[model samples]
Target: MIVDPAARRADGESVRIAKDVLCAGATVRLCLPDGPEEWAKALAKRGERRPVVVGDDRALLRVVSLLHRERDLAGSVLSMVPVGGAVSLARSLGVPTGAVAAARAVLDGAERRMDLLVDDSDGVVLGGLTIPPLRDGRGAARPASPPAHPWLSTCRSLVRGFTARPARAAAPDDAAPTRLRVEADGVTLADLDHPVAGVSVGPAARTGYARVEVHPALTAPGTAPPPSPLHADARTVTVTGADFRYRADAVVTGPVRRRTWAVRAGAWGLALPPRP
Candidate 1:
């Protein structure tokens, strides 16, 4: 078990419950260490022990990143208690929100080998995408930031819900549509310069599985193109353009001229509760 100290103060009861559960099971080891690096190092030395993360989504991402970097994901079983904020990924994976329930699920759960998305530099177990219409100081298209906590994101949603505003109407001659060339499995789907809103790629995307999504710059009125099909289960994808930036799993990494992505199936095992 790995626990983030920062999260303990905010979620003491959940942490205590998780600790009791683990204590009852003598086989489990608790790793409430100083920081991520130490925890990762400890995990690296532990070989294939079943890991139960006690933080939120960022904590999960940290573990996934470490596993991917160390090439130790093949046999690892990852479980989570969702003790902190920002647990969207956990919720999406069907893990219960409460600590006792999550711990129980961890103890009585199944092992699932899931697909992961590998890019040139990093591997994302959840999803990735490239969004147009850059915000802040970032130029052109850039990836959005991953939420810090699940509750913070919920607050954002609530705020948006209460102060929603109408979108501005589009007009002609705003800006010429930029050309985008997309190819998947030796097939060309888009090769025209038009007002691009967003592009998404994923596996079983409509069902809310792992996927890649792209949001292009807003179009002007009638210039918006119809929704295009994406190769959700594509094994490889190559994207290139000068006017766009790239983001992976909500982290903007590059504004390069070209980028490639490959999917690795059954790359990692996760400890998760059975879907209800």
Candidate 2:
């Protein structure tokens, strides 16, 4: 079993539970590495043992990345005993949240194939990806010296409420709509001529594709944005045209002007609780 340093530091109880459970049922080997180099060495040394990760999303990502680089991801079945503050990736992949339950699953579960989103850079996103808007977009679009002030803001809210469109996802204070050209399966979804509020991409269950959603920038107050934030599913998604950053699962990556992620059907195997 590999225990992430953060997990050991943040939630010792969960780590203890996982260790105890695994030790009771199997011949468990404990690996406590201090840094990335040591962690890689530990994983590299696991010759034939089915590695069980005891940590959160980042920890899992690290393991998958290592295996993928080694070209062994398709053949390896991974067991995870998530023990940290953010286990959203694990939960999304059908892993139990409770330490005891997840530990038990590690020993009792069956190996299941899982889809993955892999970028051109070999980065993996187990949960989802989000590209928040650039903050300056709103300022650029703001009408200068409007006398209505608060009234305009109120009217925009009212119109949005009555329109029955999906509520706009909140972004960070600094986020602003950016001009990006987005494409999926060779089809253009958004062009650089228009700024976009945000973009989200994630694996679509059993569909062999990833769901892509892009929110358009609202230029004028009390008016609905044109094209109503496109949504689609595709085997490949590409974003280009401007230097942009995105959050993949819990980790943020890039400021690169272009990136493409392709769905790898059953790219990795995850040990999940066996069905009844």
Candidate 3:
């Protein structure tokens, strides 16, 4: 098992629980790295033994990113025992949220294929990606936060309050709504002429496709209402606009003028709990 240092720092007890369960349930090699370099080195040398990441979504993404860089992602079967405050992506991917349950799933689960979105710069998104990347809905209105371990949730809140990036203040001359042109497959869903509140792209319900959605900017009082929001399932999604930011797999990135993402169906394998 490759244990992330951040996971150990955030919730050592949960890490201990996952480790104990994994050790007792199967023949495993524990890799307790002192830092990021060592942690990556451990994974690099993790030959033959199933690589079970004991950490949050970030660590899982790190693992996937590293493996993808090495061109070893497709042939490897991966498992994760969610152990930190930010394991929402792991939970969404069907890994058990509890330490014991997740570790147990790692031991007894079967591998399942999952879709991936690969971007122009070779970045990967295992979960949804948002244009503005707002976590709290950017207003008084917002969605409830995902559930997480009580203590881990507290820990994450404390850490985030200190380390999270400050929200970007809007600049003068900037458009009230983001102005971008979005395309799915070859059809245009949005364009620079029409401002958009936001855009998001990710795996769709249908296999071998991605769901691309463009949210229209709220109607101005005197202007005709913007076209209704557009959405479609496509093999590829492209966006071109002024510098913009995006959040993928819970990490914020980019101020790029253009970005394109293509769906790679069944690109990797993840372990899920055994069927009932």
- Report the number of clashing residue pairs per model: 12, 6, 0
lDDT per residue as tens, model 2, 31-88: 9988888878987898888889999988999999888888888878899998888887
Task: Summarize candidate 3's per-residue lDDT along 104-207 as a digit string, tens digits.
Answer: 88988999998889999999999889886223333344567865678987888899999999877655434458788899997998888877888888779998
Task: Write down the lDDT of every candidate, Cα atoms only.
Answer: 0.68, 0.86, 0.85
Candidates, ranked, lDDT: 2, 3, 1
Clashing pairs in 2: 133-176, 134-175, 134-176, 134-177, 135-175, 135-176
The regions of model 3 sitting more than 4 angstroms off are: 133-175, 222-226
Q: Model 2: runs farther than 4 Å from truth?
A: 137-174
Q: Estimate TM-scores for all models.
A: 0.73, 0.84, 0.82
TM-score of 1: 0.73
How far is 61's C-alpha from truth in model 1 (Å)? 1.3
Q: Please list the Cα RMSD from the true structure of every candidate, rounded to 1 decimal place.
A: 12.5, 8.5, 13.6
170: Cα error in model 2, Å: 14
Superior by lDDT: candidate 1 or candidate 3? 3
Best by lDDT: 2
**Full-model lDDT, candidate 2:** 0.86
